[model samples]
Target: MQVHEIQVRSILTRTGGFLREGYSHTLNPYRGCAYGGALCGLPCYAQHSVWITSGRAWGSFLDVKVNAAEVYRSQVNRERRWAATRGGLRIYMSSVTDPYVPQERQYGITRSLLEVMLDEPPERLVLQTHTPYPLWDLERLRALLPLVPDLSVNISIETDRDNLGPGFPPHATPVAERITALESLRKAGIPCVAVVAPMLPIEDPREFARRLGAACDRVVLDHFLLGDGSPGGLRTRRTGFPSKLEEAGWQQWTSLEQFEKVCDIFSEVLGADRVQKSRHGFNTPGPGRCSETTTR
Candidate 1:
């Protein structure tokens, strides 16, 4: 992969599109993702974002924002001074790239950003990633809990099957590993969310729901049809992802029918109050309402 260490003028972007309703700002530490070649990248919405991709292949390159933390500190401080209210600074850690991608270990960009947040904490902060790398910052997360009123770690586990077979890039973190990471975060007293986003083909919904019910504080169930940002999943449909599922004899998995079935199974196992769907699920009001589930 081509790696470029670059300095960015600003780190916090005003949240827009699908995420604007819940988050005020989005923080992306990098321009490209290391896992862009993996299975999840097949239907990745960010890959289609030309503004971020800059005419480059999704996983072929990574532009590290080496000055992310510094920029964040300056922006947050300036925003706080001019903001009309302090309660509106809800920030999503990442939308375009994984904050804890493999490059994080070497650069510690994500970690540095979190450290900066401890001093200038947002009203709410959501850290989302499919990798288990967050486990490396357990103590840092714990320390930020009291400072940030609505802090949660969202881990995505789209399917039960670890291996999606040939033709797909191998997954960086398997389903089981992500579940284990969720369990560990929950055990550490962190508010944990399991995101089954753009639901993939599952071997058993019941078993999968059971695993998530036990591992996370709540579950966010999503299908590409509803969660892919574009109306009716047009963005995802433009990719070869749908044809791939069909080739695997899992055509049924490509529809909302399976998404609803899995949602029901999750609700049954985790209780209706703990299960949320689509955009509403993602916007579920923070850790304070752990028992509340948004169906709309």
Candidate 2:
């Protein structure tokens, strides 16, 4: 893997495209994801963007935004001054990159940004990752929570079966580890959510939901075809995921029927209020400021 330290003009970006409806802004400390070659990449819509691809294959390289924290401070101060005209900032820690990838242990770019946020908290902040590195800053997250009441930590664990992950992307964290982290965070009194994104084949749906309910406050279920940028999951189809499933005799995993069944089981186990389906979790409104913020 090749790593480059690149300078960026800005850190915070007004959420656009598919994310606009969910978040007001996005702060990606890294340009590309280290999980690029992992199962998560199979359905990642960001990989399809010409801007990120730049003629290079996904997950083969990483560009560290070296000045992310400094840029974020400037953006936050600017936003604070215009708070009256604008609206409370609900920033997603990352959109296209895993904020806590292995490279983070060396550069601490995501950690630095978290420190900045500690001083000036956003109205709502969601820290999403599929790795355990974020646990390194458990105390920091706990401290920042009091300042930012609407903060949430979402761990993206696609399936209970870790074996299936490497078949798609070679480097994703094990599903069990992710669930353990989720349980740890919840135990620490941090608001947590387990995101079964691009919901993969599970050995047992009831057991998965029961485990998730015990680990986190809520659960979100999504299918690759629904979240993929391509309508009807054309992007996933291009990757031959469906064909792979058929060959593996797991063809049922390729259809939305499986996703719907899993959702129903989750609702039964976790309670309908705690189980979120499709894109609903993203659009769910946080307790915002004293005004109605336009999600779009």
Candidate 3:
């Protein structure tokens, strides 16, 4: 992977379109995702964003915002002032790239951003990723709990099966390992959430839901057709994801029928109050808030 240390003019971006509902701003420490070649990136809607990619191949290059923390420190106060007039500031750590990607171990950009947030906490903060790298800052996260009014860690586990067959890029974290990370975060008294986005082929839905119930406070279930951030999943259709699923003999999962079935199964196991769907689920209040089941 080609890594570039570039400086960004801004670290916090105003949320709109897909993320407009719950969050006031979004913070991405990096431009391109290191896991862009991983399993999750196959159907990633972010890859289709030409403005961010700038014609670079997904996963082939990574632009690290070396001064992300500095930029955030400078702009956060002004942004917070602006947000206060409109609504309380709520920041989503990342929307396009994983905050805990592997490069984070060396650069510490995400860690630095969190440190700055410690000094200037937001009304609400959500850290979302599909990797176990968050454990690197467990103590730091614990320190922020009392400081940040609302804080939650969202871990995406798309499927129960660890392997999705050949031709797919290797996952950053295996299924079992990700669940273990969630367990650790929950044990640390951190608010944890399991995001099963674009629900993949699961060997057993009940067991999967049960596992998630034990690991996190609540679960968000979604399918590409409903949650791909496009009208009728137009962007996802442009990828080979559908064909890959079909080749794996899981074509039935390409439709909403299986997704709905899995949602019902999840509700049955995790309780309807704990089960949520798509954008509505993501926009729901942060951890420790009352739970409401979204209509499937």
Candidate 4:
């Protein structure tokens, strides 16, 4: 993989589209995620974005936003002044990229950004990723909690199977490790959730929900057809994910029927109040506020 240290003019971006309902702003510390080559690569909506993709392979390159923390500091200062007329900033960190990728250990850009947030904290910060690296900054995250108590870290676990999928990337963290990370984070008093986004085929829906309920505070279920960053999950369909599922003897996973079935089981096991659906739950509301509960 090629690494490029690129400087960005801005860190916080006004969010729209699927993220508009829950988050006010989005911050991505890096461009092109290291885990992009996994099964997610097949249906990754971000890859369809011309700006970040730049016609390059998804995992072939990583652009470290070297000045992300510095830029965020200035942005937060400005946002604070602007927020008086509006409301507290609900920022989703790393909407398009994973903040705690392997590069983070060396550069600490995500941690640096968190340090800046500690100084001028937002009302709510949702940190999302699919790896165990968030444990690396547990202390930093714990410190920020007093300032932004509503902060949440969502660990994306697409399926319960250890194989992940038929053609998942070898470098991606194992399914069991992610579940263990969620348990650790929950035990550490960090508000966390399990995101079954683009929900893949699971061996046992009841077992998955039971495990997630034990690990995190709540669960959010989604499927490729519902939230694949396209009008009709066209990007995912074009990747042949449906055909792949059929060939793998998991054809039911290609349809929303199975997704809803799994969601129903999760609701039954975890309770309806504890199970959120689609992007609405993934982008939870700020502190002292109630988000409109939604399902799909």
Clashes of each: 0, 2, 0, 0
Error of 2 at 117 (Å): 0.6
lDDT, residue 73, candidate 3:
90
The residue pairs found clashing in candidate 4 are: none
Better of 1 and 2 by lDDT: 1
Q: Is candidate 1 or candidate 2 better by TM-score?
A: 1
Q: Between which residue pairs do clashes occur in model 2?
A: 38-169, 39-169
- For each candidate in turn, the TM-score is 0.94, 0.91, 0.95, 0.92
Predicted structure 1: clash tally: 0
lDDT of 1 by residue, 1-296 (tens): 99999999999887778887788788999998999998888888788888888999988889999999999988996665544353478888888899989999999999999999999998888999979889999999989988988999999998898877777777768888899998888878888899998788888899998888888788898988898888778999887798888898889988988789888888888889889999998877665523224221
> Candidate 2 lDDT, tens digit per residue, 190-264?
777888887878999999999988888788888877876578888778777777777777888888888888899
Q: For each candidate, C-alpha RMSD in Å?
A: 3.1, 5.1, 3.3, 4.0
Worst 10 residues of 2 by lDDT: 287-296
Off-target runs (Cα >4 Å) in candidate 1 are: 81-87, 289-296
Task: Please report, as a residue range, the 10-residue window in candidate 4 with the lowest summed lDDT.
Answer: 287-296
> Ten-residue segment with the worst summed lDDT in candidate 1?
287-296
**Which should have the higher lDDT, number 2 or number 3?**
3
Which stretches of candidate 4 lie above 4 Å from their native place?
81-86, 164-166, 286-296
Name the runs in model 3 displaced over 4 angstroms. 289-296
Model 2 ranges off by over 4 Å: 80-87, 165-171, 285-296
lDDT of each: 0.85, 0.79, 0.87, 0.81
